[model samples]
Target chain A: MKTWIEKQKALIDFTLASLARRKIKNLGLLLVYTLIVFLLASVMLFTHALRKEAGKVLENSPEVIVQRLVAGRHDLIPPGYLEKIGRIRGVQKKEGRLWGYYYDGVLKANYTFMVPQPDALMAVESGKIAVGATMARMRGLVPGNTISFRSYSGKLFSFEVSSVLPNKSELVSADLVLLSEADFRAFFELPPGYYNDIVLSVANPLEVRNIATKLSTLLPDSRPILREEVLRTYESIFNWREGIVLVLLSGAILAFAIFAWEKASGLSAEEKREIGILKAIGWETGDVIKMKFWEGALVSLAAFLLGYIAAYLHVFRFSSWLFEPVLKGWAVLYPRFELTPEVDGFQVATLFLFTVFPYAVATIVPIWRAAITDPDAVMRG
Target chain B: MIEVSEVRKAFNQGRHNEYWALKGISLTIEAKKVTALCGPSGSGKTTLLTIIGCLARPTSGRVRLKERDISGLPERFLTDIRRSTFGFVFQQFNLIKGLSALDNVMLPAYPLGGDWRALRARAESLLDSLGLAHRREARVEWLSGGEQQRVAIARALVNDPEVLIADEPTANLDTALSKEFLAILEALAEQGRTVLLTSHDPLVVEAAVIDSVIDMRDGQIVGIR
Candidate 1:
């Protein structure tokens, strides 16, 4: 057993040394394979991290919300609707919320405005608002800075920055400005008695449905939204964006796969004959397989590490601009996100199994065929 | 130690096409003896040598090495036998192109796996004994044909295989180098090692100094002289 182990080690060492001698050819293959693995690892890591980050943002949101819907549109609810909902049996607390979308013509960007509360879970200082970290960085805005924008009615408004929000929500958290209820109404030029939605806190979170039923009887035009529904919407948008990325990157994947297959299958007759010679001289089929396995593994590992590091810097530090247009459907200034390098062992393992394993398996059929070919026929060449 | 019984090998070119490279031929090679198989070109000498070396299997009949039927062994086991017990020197001097002479000598023993120091020492001793110490570090391509032949011989002998099989070992060498190459084989045989050599040169036959000579033609043994 000791001798056998030694023999295997020798074979591996010899194979690696031989590869080093032919560095140009082998390293070229390694680079290509590594790039593919890197892309795969980066996508997996970023997507998985996005879910956790988005979840953190949603954790602080209301358990249930009631929005007025009319003819499939979310219409504004009357301010007096909050008073009626607050009196419901399961309601713990209820508040009318004001929010609207505004466009910055100069920056070609959109921002969201939401009513802030002094003691609310997501409150900010009066006349001053919190912005998404990414939005603040891109717009070059900071605390005490003022950003001006135009509402849908073409009315101009401005707000002073109080603080910047953490970039925990990657895809779901819109670039936002948080103001007091009065400030939101004034900025959007809305009447004193209107709101976009009514956010509710419940004594029993699970009683949201019962509260919604009660509110339906009191205000039939309004629909209740469970927290899960909002989360599903967020997931759907991300999934759609992920599908687009998959489609756009499919060509690169196919090109790399073809490059790998061509390299494996297009060995010259001389190379085929060399394999025959090695087999004839006493190399086991298993040994040949192992040699090729190492070749694939070494290449993919290097590519994965380099590509992953590049993607980490590109996405987290540089705000994932490379994928922004494809993901967002337009060029939008992404806020800076400090992504802690999260090494997911399961994800790394999966990427290895997915990217490297198949390429290694694909290589075997061709190499095995070449190795087992009749030595006489090989020698004849 | 080597026996062939009515061995026949046939290759199919394609549909409805068949060619017999070797016919039913029987020969026995004695233990610890040097035997030379001599024949003209296209006379099946190389095919018979390959069969004896366990590099190829005869399509019919059987080959026995020390009473063990090797023809029935799987390709992988046959290869193991070749590496552990049989050494081959081909006519083309099949040294891996980019490797140095020392590395070439060490190639056969690589699978055996010893301490690096011991392996290197063994390879160095072989090169020195073969009078190739000066060219030990030279790449196979940079070596002369004679030097390359010496390296090939060193590779074959490095594993201390039980049988040394040389197919046209000196076919590409000058008369002087060929004579020098045969002297090394003579010394190996003197150490009680079995050496099976194939050659077409009359000068090689004269310089054999072996215990037996087998002449082959048309895949059959024509004479055992």
Candidate 2:
């Protein structure tokens, strides 16, 4: 056992020296290989981070949202639907939500306006507002700055920026403006007893679907969106987008794979001679295969580490700007946020198994085929 | 000592291009002596050397090393026997190009599964004896043909095998370097190691140290002198 380990170590040492001897060609292959890994890993890490971020915010979301539908389109929910939903079993808490999209013609961007709850982090007075970090950045508004937006009825309303949400909440609160209920209603021209939706929390989490079904039967026009369903929808959306991008990027990966396969499978005349010489000098077929295995392993492992680390830094530090449009959302105004750095061992292992294993296999076949040939024949050539 | 009996090798068997590289031939290689297989190109000198060297298996018949039949053995067993019993030198001086001479010398020891330090020591000793101690760190690609040949010889001897098989060992060397290489082979043979070599050059085949010369024609032994 000790000798086997020593032999492997010696072989690996020889492989490293061999790689260094062809430093230029090997390094070029390493750089390109690393780039491929980086791109794929960045997409994976960015999507994972987005899902995790969405999950964190979703943990605080209401268990169910009841929205009134008119002619299959979302309409304002009457305040009376709250009473009907409150009577359902397992109902814990119910709140009327007042929110609407506010488009600023001046900035040519859309901002989401919502009524602030009494216990909200930011207190908004009638003539003042609290904006999200991204919103403040885009509008160039700081605390105490007056920003004006024309309401849906053409009434211009101006409010002092009271505060900006912190960066930690940027994903959820980006492009959000919080104001008093009266101000929000007036700005959106919503009548009394009408709200965007009714958010409900259930005392028994497992009975949320049952309560939703009861609400649907009681109020046929109301649509109840379960929190679980919302989460699954978000999960599928990100996964679908990732799949599409991966499919598109598969062409590039395939091209590189072909290049790598050709590079690995087609031994140069010098390399063939080297193998022949090694075999001639009392090295077995197994020994030659083992050496080639080390060669393949060293190249792939190095590429994986370099590519994965670069992807981590790219996604976590730079917020995956390269893939933000495809991953974060297809919107003109994207949320300015950074992904949390967290390593998924399974994903990393899967990537290694998928990326490096195939290359190793591809490399071994050619080496094995060559190794089994008559060394005398190869040496003569 | 090595013995070959009724050995035959056919290439591309049963096909239109089927050709026999070696016919039923027999020979005995004595220990502690230098023997030469002399023939021109297409005369099967190299093929017979390769068969005796265990680099290629004979199509039929048996080869014995000290009375052990190695002809019908599996490839793995044949490989083990080859590793422990024989070392080889090729006509082209097939040294791995990117590696230093020392590295090439140490290549065979890598698979023997021993401490690298011990392997390095053995390789150094061999290189020292070959008068290549100063050029140990030089890559074979930058070495002269004679230097490369020395490296190849050192690599073949590093394992300390019982038999050393050289296929056209002096093919790429000048007359002077060829004499130097033959002198090394003679010294190795004097040290009680069996030395078997192939050469068409009269300078090598007619060396004073050679104990016998086996001449071949058409893959069969034509004469022994």
Candidate 3:
């Protein structure tokens, strides 16, 4: 009997020659299979990267935030809430903030604002107002330049841009502008002591829930928000988008599965007779199985590689357009992000095992059954 | 050497269908002899040959090759026995259409790998000896029926099996080609290899230098000569 390696080599050689003979059919199958895989890989990579970016932005943000809820609407807390929240034992530092939404009637764009620099009081900046990089670029605004718009209260407010900031978080930074608390009040014509919210930094984040409970009891109308809650909301939104993508692309996956099964099992009567001839010539059932295995492996491996490469270029590079609706929902996503190509070796290995191995195994079942039959019976047909 | 003891094989069902292909027939083929099993269509000639070659299991009774009972062996073991001990030549030649005549001949040796160069040398010599050396590189599909038959013969003999089985070996060929093919089989028999062949042609049965003839009708051997 021939050694296992010799049998494998012969099987591989024969399989390759057979595929080469049917170039057109095999090539068409390969192209379609690869395209689906590419799309899947790109979506997986882009969504994963977006999750990481959003997490990072939240992690570096304030531990707790105090906002006023009125008639099912989130309103700004008075500036005095800052001093009251600062007195809590676990609170390391507390700062009052002023933020609001503005609209450009000419450009038909929405802009969000937060107090900046000195009294602005967040980890990001103080009195200097920051604007989104994309918005600045689109509107032709630069640092130390004034941009004016109408606030939600319908009052016209103008502020000098302190610096144009890159959209670090595409989910959040798209249409944002920043200013000092005094500037925020003056621009929106707020009373002297009023502010939007008080953001607090805690030494230990795990104690945030306990602290918020105490704050709620002490201050009835004001509510405490944890950064974790914000991050969870973002994750839920992305999870929904992932589900939609999976549903939309599932048809392609099913088509690929069917095509692979058909290629493996749907041998013609002529092909069966040929298999009989080989068997009658003393070829083992294992050799016949090995030949079909090579055919499956070659087709799937080629498709996997080609599809992954195409997805990287088409889906990841231009992901901002593909996924914008899901990420932004009703809110507009201003800074479109470019996904960095992340090849997860484990994920790729899993994909190959899950997607290709079963198909290859499926191809062999019918061939094995036919090969083990009486060679004379096969030849007679 | 091949021994068949009261082997039975059947096919299909009911009053209209349940017909035996081979029925309680016993035969022995001596080592190094060219023996032909001849009968008309549906006479169990091919069925008997398949049982003798270990390509099919009998519905009853035992078959032994070189004193080893092959009937009860597992499929894998039977496959190994077939690979090492038997070589088959089909009526249609059954050459893979895409391969060269040499490749077709060398195929059976692929499982018994040693030096592929040595296998190639052996295949080339067998084809050369059979007057097919000039057509060694030609695709099997492009070859004449006679040429394809010679290639099939070469393939059957390539692995140096103890038993050579050829089913209706010349059914597709002209009289001249059939005679030429029989001449090759006679040469292999002279080399002390046991050959079991099936045929419906009386001319093929008469022209060949066979040691014995087993005649069958209705799946049962009616006479022996």
Highest DockQ model number: 2
**Residue A175, model 3, lDDT:** 76
> What local distance difference test score does each model get?
0.75, 0.85, 0.77
Q: Per model, how many backbone clashes are there?
A: 3, 0, 11
Select the stronger candidate by lDDT from 2 and 3.
2
**TM per candidate:** 0.91, 0.95, 0.89
Candidate 2 ranges with C-alpha deviation above 4 Å: A84-86, A329-331
Error of 3 at B177 (Å): 2.4
Provide DockQ values for all models, in the order shown: 0.52, 0.73, 0.52
Q: How well is candidate 2 docked (DockQ)?
A: 0.73
Tell me the tens digit of each residue's lDDT in model 3 across A22-53: 68878877876676677677667666667776
Fraction of native Cα contacts kept in each candidate? 0.39, 0.80, 0.48
| Candidate 3 Cα outliers beyond 4 Å, as residue runs | A117-130, A137-147, A151-163, A167-171, A180-182, A318-324, A327-330, A343-350, B13-16, B112-117, B131-138, B222-225
Better of 1 and 3 by lDDT: 3
Q: Write the per-residue lDDT of candidate 1 for residues B52-105, one digit (tens) a residue.
A: 877788889999988999998887778788888887777887777676898777
- When 1 and 2 are scored with lDDT, the better candidate is 2
The Cα error of candidate 1 at residue A16, in Å, is: 1.2
Please provide, for model 3 over B1-225, each residue's C-alpha lDDT reduced to its tens digit, 9 standing for 90 to 100: 678899898777356778888879888889988888888989988788877777888888999877989988877788788878888887777888778899899888776655677888999999999999999999899999999988988898888888888889888988898888778877877788888889878877886488888888988888888
Candidate 1 clashing pairs? A34-A303, A134-A335, A134-A336
